[model samples]
Target: MISVAAIDARIWQAIVAGAFVAIGWIVNGWQNRRVAAALRAERTRDVHRALYAEIASCLANLDSPEALAAYRDAMAARMRDDPGFVPLIPRERNDTVFRALVAEIHILPRVTIDPVVSYYSQLFAIEAMIADMRGERFRALEPERRIAMYEDYIALKVQAFHDGHFALRMIDAYATDGRNGAMEEEARITREISAGFDTAGAAARAASRISSPGAVRSGRSPE
Candidate 1:
C-alpha cells in the first residue's frame, strides 16, 4: 500500500501537469484567434483596394468614346458568356465613398436636406439598367434581336424618367399648397441629382483618357 504522503505528492504532480496543459491550450487558442482576425482584416483591406483600382481604371478610360463603346460591347459579351456575372447594379467608386460620407453627415441631429438617399436610389436604378443590359440573356440574342430589345429598354427608361418628373412636380405642387417641408425635400433631391451628374461627368472624362494608346502603354509599364 502507498503511504499517505506519497499519494498526496502524486495527486499534486498530476494537478500541476493538468494546469500546464490548460495554460498551453489557452495560449494557443488566443494566438489562433489573433492570427484569424489579422487575416480577415487583411482580406477586407485587399478587397477595398481592388475596388478602388477598378474605379480608377473606369475613370481613366472614360475619355475615349470608342473605348467606352468597346467596353460596353465587351461587357455585353461577358454577360453572354456568364449570366451569373451580372451584378444587380453598377457601383461607382464615388458612390461607395459618398455613402460613407453621407453616413457621417447623417450623424448630425438635424440635416435639412436628405440628398444621400435620393441620389443613391437614382444611381442604383441606372446601375441596375446597365447590369441588366450586360446579362447573358441580353447578350446571347442576335444583333438584330438585341437592337430591338435595346430600343424597348430605352423607351422604358424614358417613360420611367417622365413618370419620376411628373411625381416630383406633383409633390412640389402639394408642398406649395400646404407645408414648406415638402419643398425642402424636393430641393434636396434636386441637389443630389446635380451632384450625381457632375460626378458622372468627371468619371466619364477620366474613362475617356484611359482609353488612349499612350495611357494604355503607361498603365502596362512595371510599377
Candidate 2:
C-alpha cells in the first residue's frame, strides 16, 4: 500500500535524470564535432603551407633570370656542340611533401586540388621526358629530331612553370579564405609573363634551324 503520490514523485525523478543524460550526450557529441572540424581546417592549412613553400621554391628556380640565362646558354651549347650532347636540364628530385600528402589532398578545397595536381602532373611529365632523353632511342634520332626533342623538353618545363603559378594562385586564394582580389595582382602579373613566353615559337625556331642545310652533326652515342 504505497501512496500514489510517492510513485508519481519517483516517475518525475526518473524523467529528470533521463533528460539530463540526453543533454549530456548531445553536448558531448557537439563538442567532438567542433574539435574535429577545427582539426580538419588546421590540417588543410598545413597542407597549403607546405605546398606553397615547395611551389614557390620551384617557381624561384625556374622563373628566375639566372635560370633562364643558364638554360639558354645550355641549349646554345647543345646546338653548337655535338647534336648528341645532352643538355643538363635542372629539375627537382624532391617531391616528398606532395607524395606523402597526396592521398589527403582531397581534404583541400575542391578548386585548389585540380591545379595542385596539374602542377605535379606536369612535373612528372618533365621527369618522363628527361628519362627518355637519356635513353638509347633519343641517341638514335636524327640531328633535327634531337633538336626538336630538346625543344619539346624546354616547352614542358615552361608549361610546368605556368602550372606552378596556377597552383600557387589557388592556394593563395584558399589561404586567404576566398577574399576578393586576394590573388588578382599576382594573376595579372603571371598572365603578362606567360604572354611573353612563346614556347611554340621557340620550338619552331629551333626545329627550323636544325632543318636548314648546315646543322650540327650527331657525335658518338652516349656511353
Candidate 3:
C-alpha cells in the first residue's frame, strides 16, 4: 500500500503539471488572437488603398474640366446636322477590385460603405446610359429628343463626378485615421471641382446665347 504522504506528494505534482499546461494553452491562444488581429487590420488597410487608387483613377478620367468643355463644343457644333451625335463618353469601365472584394466591403468603416456603394451605383448608371446611346432606340428619337437624352447623360456624368469625389474623401479620411485635417483639404478640392463644372456650364450657356442672335439675324431658329 502507498503511504499517505507519498500519495499526497504525487497528487500535488500532477496538479502543478496540469496548471502549467493550462497556462501554456491560454498564452498560445492569446498570441494567436493578437497576430490574427494585426493581419486583419493590415488587410483592411490594403483594401482601402486599392479601392482609393482605383476610384481616384476613375475620377481622374472624368474630372477633366477641359474634356467636359470639349464635349460641349463638339455637341453644339454637330447638333444641327448630326442629331444622332453622342458626346464623348469615357470608355466602359470595370470595377474589378470592387467586384472581387464587395463581400468584404463591410470591413470598411461603417460610414464609408454607403458612399462607396453610392459612387459605384452612379458609375453603373453612367455606363448603362452609354450602352443605351449605342442602341437603335437612341437613334430613332427626334433631334430634340436626342438632345434631351444627351443633356440627361451630361447631368449623370456631373453627378458621378460629385459622387466619386465624395467617395474619395471618405476613403481618404478613413485611411489617414481621420487625422491631418483631411476634411478641409477635401472640401477645398470639392469646391474647386464644382466650380469647374459651373464655369464650363456658364461658358456653354453664354456661347449659346451669343449664337442665338446670329440665328435670329439669319432668319433661322436657334438650335
Top-lDDT candidate index? 2
- Ranking by lDDT, best first? 2, 3, 1
Model 3 per-residue lDDT tens digits across residues 101-122: 8988877655466777988898
State the lDDT of candidate 2 residue by residue for 1-223, as single tens digits: 9899999999999999999999999999999987777777777767777776677666665654345547755775676588656555444564678998988887876566777899899988888998888787877877667778787877777777667766665566555534233346346546766788533222223222312121111111111
Candidate 2 clashing pairs, residues 3+ apart or interchain: none
Q: Go through the candidates in order and give each one's C-alpha lDDT.
A: 0.44, 0.65, 0.63
Predicted candidate 1 versus true structure: per-residue lDDT over 109-209, tens digit per residue: 12211322443355466567666767887666676566545544444333333333323232222223322444554565568677764323333443333
Top candidate (TM-score): 2
Clashing pairs in 3: none
Candidates 2 and 3: which is better by lDDT? 2
Give the lDDT of residue 153 in candidate 3.
Answer: 80
RMSD of each: 17.3, 14.1, 14.8
Query: Taking the candidates one at a time, how many backbone clashes does each contain?
Result: 13, 0, 0
